[model samples]
Target: MTTQHLEHPTHTHTHGPDCGHQAVSHGDHVDYAHDGHLHREHSGHWDECESGAHTTHDGHTHVHGSDCGHEAVRHGDHVDYVHDGHRHAEHDGHYDDH
Candidate 1:
């Protein structure tokens, strides 16, 4: 996976306690889930955070989305869907273990 250095557009508010976004601890920093994406404060701007490595879910057939039957869970920087007894995170064009 490639690391992206894109700044979040239309991000105007500060993220913290009571910021209405889910916060997840990431290494020595924290990331907030915003607008279906993850944002982290860097320098003086908000940067989009993403994972570089993922375990691909091979041979999976069902599709997961906003209206899917599984429950949607807010992970570190993305949403994961609860399926069977585990969580599936969308990565690239496939799903990964959460």
Candidate 2:
């Protein structure tokens, strides 16, 4: 008997033109404007192991996945958690409030 380990194929999707486009590293940081001068928020760093849902300082929700890119949507009772292109029942429990 022979045993083989198969690795999942990685798929890449480009948002902008493919002209010398590269992936953004988590160490990258950007400044935001509040009133006049530029303001910094939350160190502007992202964790490599940090997957799934994320909340911004502005109270906005974002979801990230290996299969799907980042998606912004309203959080709260109406939000749904999707994993690998499938909606899990874990998020359905929160729907009871509605």
- The residue-by-residue lDDT of candidate 2 on 1-98, one tens digit each, is 11122221231222222423222222233222212212222323311222234322232233343444532222223332333332222232221110
For model 1, name the residue pairs that clash.
none
Candidate 2: residue 73 lDDT (0-100): 25
Screening candidate 2 with a backbone cut-off below 3 angstroms (N, C-alpha, C), the clashing residue pairs are: none
Error of 1 at 48 (Å): 1.0
Question: Model 1: per-residue lDDT, tens digit, 1-98?
Answer: 44367788678989997998877655556677777777889888898876555657788789999888886757655677767655578878888854
lDDT of 1 at 11: 86
TM-score of 2: 0.17
Instruction: Give Cα-based local distance difference scores for all models.
Output: 0.73, 0.26
Candidate 2 error regions (>4 Å): 1-8, 12-19, 28-51, 59-98
